[model samples]
Target: MRLWQRIFLIGLVLWLATVVVTNWTGNSNLVPTVVLFGSFLVPVTFVVWAYGRGRSPRVTVELLFVAFVVGGALGVLGASLLESWLVHPSIGMYVVVGLIEEGVKLAALMFVTRHMTKRTTMDGVILGATVGFGFAAFESAGYAFNALFTSEGLSLRQLVETEVLRGILAPVGHGLWTAILGGVLFAAAGRLTTTVMLSYLGVSLLHALWDSMNAIAIAVTLALTGHAWQFALLRIGRVPHVTEWQVHVYTLVNWAGLVAISLVALCWLWMTVRSGRRRREILSQ
Candidate 1:
């Protein structure tokens, strides 16, 4: 019914599904409670903050929630489908995958939270976080599950450390980058501001670049190594039953890139808001 209510319900359901599946697969104990909570908590908080900021109608917020869920499912599915033909799938080759996923998630946010005002900047930031959150929630489940269900469980120390790092980093990963889209585009359509869509395109491009970084890296790696086999790309839906340097790169780089993107988004939002306020003051005189 309400946006927060729906987000809570969807989040709870996904969490439960994550726990139950891990349990069945013998990775139950590997599920870090803190990591799971942190994964959902940050983004959901952003969603709540956005709700207060936009005063968007109840129905539209619900749609945003749906965007999170539906967009994630579609993103993973698209990734899987695209990788079906290749030796393994990667997000880099198909920039469309990133664009479509973030675009749709942000679109849902923009359409539902429509309003034209500089005042909605914080909401934009929050919703951008929400989009990232939705993507992270699903993505985390896959990673956590991979860690747990493999032949052996990670040591308690390793488990604790990995989860802690991931927890700390999760907010910035997919959710914040997508949040840039949500934040800027929402501002554009609602605020009647010039350069709004252009700014949004910039945000979206950053998002696509964020996904493509590893792909590009892998390609370079392949070329330099002079390998004929497709050893450079990440093999999706297949964990090596243990973490390695390459896997670590994939995990940590994604986290770091998103965090960097967030810093950039924050700067953009800050400038947009300050300039808008100055413009308003000038016009008021």
Candidate 2:
């Protein structure tokens, strides 16, 4: 089997084991252990895969570590502060969050690699991924923590379920989005060119769409089921006594939206990589 495939399999197996052990044992201490392992699984797997694929001598272990650790921490810290200060609770908040997060990550990437001169698209991908994954890992931990406690006491099952869902979705979210932006940023040689600006905005919009996917699904569900779309706003804290057919419809649309977003991000990454390769070829000639 391929290296990345092997890594992915190992991560997946370990995650499943962690989930099973934590839930079966109902151990509180094991909850964080499981959360950390599950959260880091896919992001770490993808980072390693990117590293192998790049095979760039420019991307050193120190650099990757710094990018992942420092960059990710800074991105999370900055985004949290800025989001709290700048964003209010509203419909547009998700879009604002995308802007803040993508911007902060880009800034974190810049800050982490400010001294490095020989930057390439591959370096960007690796480092951007490091930052993105770092952000994801921290963010997932927070979400897992929050998911642990509802009105009830510690909910290990809820925590594990949240981690599993986020872990499954992590690769296509922050990591891919930032990688695309980083590729464009490095391809432009750190200049804020039109392409770079547009790429950043485009990725931010995709980020917004991703964060809004559940709401969008709910809206669609309400509309298609002949329910008032405005009632979606009241969905919070109140589980509607919907028909089985409605429930199925909501599930189908939600999963389909998530899949669609994943495909879009993947396609964006593929195009960015292809563009980077072409740029390299032209420069080589």
Candidate 3:
């Protein structure tokens, strides 16, 4: 079996064992283990897979490892600092968040790969994906950890659910976004050209739309169900109880939005990869 396959199987087994042990023993110390393992497993597996698939001869395992660790750390830290200072609760909050997060991840990728004399779109995709997965892993850990604590107390079930959901969605999130950005950045030879800027904006828009999808779904549900007046109640700190049908509609809308966004991102990445390969071929010739 390939290395990524091995990593996924082993990591999945370990994470499951950790979850079982923590739940059986009610040991708080093992909580961190479960959170980290569950959060990092998918991202790590995907990164290894990307490394195996990447054709850039200059990109090495060691560099990918560093990008995954250091680049992810820098992205997370920079995003947190900037978001805390600049973000506020508003209609455009997710948009700002998308901009800040994608910006920082790009910066982190650039920082980690700064010394490379030769760069290619494929290399950027691999390394950018490494950094993005790193960010996703760390960010997922935080979300899982927070899910553990609630008003009622420790919530292992909630934590597990959070991890599972995020794990399932990991590939279509930060990894995909940064992969697109990195391809553009590297295609421009590290310059912030207009094409690169447009790619950044495009990914950031996707990010914002993704983050706001649930709310958008809710709004759509309300409108469809003739409950749009509840928006006023929400504005005034009241959450009007949603009908069962509305809940179903919201779920459908939310998931449909996510699927559409994921499809678009996947298509964009495919085009980017194809363009990169063509560029490489021309250069080689």
Tens-digit lDDT string for candidate 1 (192-284): 355655665676676676667666554444444432233433344332232255455555655566667668766766675565456557868
Model 1, position 119: C-alpha lDDT score: 35
Report residue 180 deviation for candidate 1 (angstroms): 2.8
What TM-score does structure 2 among the candidates reach?
Answer: 0.89
Count clashes in each candidate, considering only residues at least 3 apart in sequence or on different chains: 7, 0, 0
lDDT of each: 0.56, 0.85, 0.94
- The numbered model that scores best in lDDT is 3
lDDT of 3 by residue, 1-285 (tens): 999999999999999999999999999999999999999999999998998888567898889889999999999999999999999999999999999999999999999999998889999899989999999999999999999999999999999999999999999999999999998899999989999999999999999999999989987888888465677788899878877888899999999999999999999999999999999999899
TM-score of each: 0.54, 0.89, 0.96
| Superposition-based RMSD of candidate 1 using all C-alpha atoms, in angstroms | 8.4
Against the true structure, what is every candidate's RMSD? Answer: 8.4, 2.9, 1.5
> By TM-score, highest first, what's the ranking?
3, 2, 1
Better of 1 and 2 by TM-score: 2
Better of 1 and 2 by lDDT: 2
